[model samples]
Target: MSFFYSSIVKFEIEFFGHENIRSNHQKTIEITKESHLTPQGDCIVGVNATSSCADLPLELKNKLKNSNSKIKFTISVGDDEFILEGRGHPELILAHTKDIVIRKSDFICPRTLAIKCDKASDLLPRTMVSLLQNPKTKGTFTIDID
Candidate 1:
């Protein structure tokens, strides 16, 4: 006989208005319910929005719309913001950038960030494992609010 084990985790990321935009830009952003498993073993996030009027350019918006993978943004322990791109499983490709931040009062546990993995081994090299393992780090992980 043969046996296999599979597990899945779901996360939510909230988009906050850009720095230059008003605190309440009043734009609408939508996320879809479709989920994917990344190669690294993380759930691929989904967003479904009919329209978004935020400051994001049309090209970027299109990119988000056409993206068939899980897209994530996070603030590293060093306070640098990064975007994690994955397809069909947790094959996380990290993109370093300066345009990410953590917002308070957005959820019950604002610091609870979600990490996706396709293989358990991929997490062995991450420092976030300890933080994510902590029971305190349990909040809805969102990518963008709008």
Candidate 2:
């Protein structure tokens, strides 16, 4: 018998913080491709994102569709780096064009990137959130599926 194993898939997204970034939502965190952010987008940490859920590679997306897949989401800005862990679901249809959201709840939507995330925007470090409120801050988001 032949054996097959799948390897981890990883990708990075570059984004810039927006002046309106609140990073205060209790249940979710988000990065958006839109050039502008409203004050009401309290979950948004970064805007002008280089990639949305729709921009992810097919291989990565396919792996993320597996319920057994574990995901690591890392966000780095300046000298601060934060990591969040979550799980993927078979019901995920990651096809949103403008946003990628990680949620503390199991609610799945086109914009949802991961579910049952360990941290939400409100749980982020205050220093990091302050940096994210500045439009000049550069942010890197890395997604790893294992």
Candidate 3:
């Protein structure tokens, strides 16, 4: 009789660093579920008028619709304001998330905002990203409606 035993090592890695968390912390910004502060100090924002985020400000909605091909929006975090430019696909935000089907019900055509950060790492926190993309999460960001 021969006995064979195998041990599979499952390593869970964390991508977020101190700078990444700092970049996302202490800033009161309405982040639509699509918005997330990447470990690289960058943020991914979504500009959409889907039913899920219809409650957003009218001006913001207009900007999202009229911006059309343009991918730039001014946002406020804590006291500082930044101009977020559109880069990645809106669906990319979804793909970055875990359970996308639950939150994404209707077929929404939303634009993307790829904000850059100077002090971010190439890696991100898996836990934080999970919360950002959670179905129960509501996307919100604090910006000047005027």
Winning model by lDDT: 2
Put down candidate 3 lDDT per residue, 1-146, tens digits, no spaces: 99976421111111111222322332121232333344443333222213233344444444433323233334322233344333222232222221111111123333222222112211224344444343333333332211
Ranking of all candidate structures by their lDDT, best first: 2, 3, 1
Among these predictions, the greatest TM-score belongs to: 2
Question: Candidate 1 on 1-146: residue-level lDDT in tens?
Answer: 99875322233433221112111211111122222212232211111212122423433334433325344433232232334332221221222121221212122121112223122212222343333333233213234311
RMSD in Å for all candidates: 17.4, 2.5, 19.3
lDDT comparing candidate 2 with the true structure: 0.92
Candidate 1: minimum summed lDDT over ten consecutive residues — where? 21-30
lDDT minimum window of 10 residues, candidate 2: 2-11
Query: How accurate locally, in lDDT, is each candidate?
Result: 0.26, 0.92, 0.29
**Candidate 3 error regions (>4 Å):** 1-30, 33-52, 57-63, 67-71, 87-146
TM-score ranking from best to worst?
2, 3, 1
Residue 122 displacement (Å), model 3:
7.2
TM-score of 1: 0.24
lDDT of 1 at 82: 33
lDDT of 2 by residue, 32-85 (tens): 999888899999999999999999999999988888999999999999999999
Residue-level lDDT for 139 in candidate 2? 96
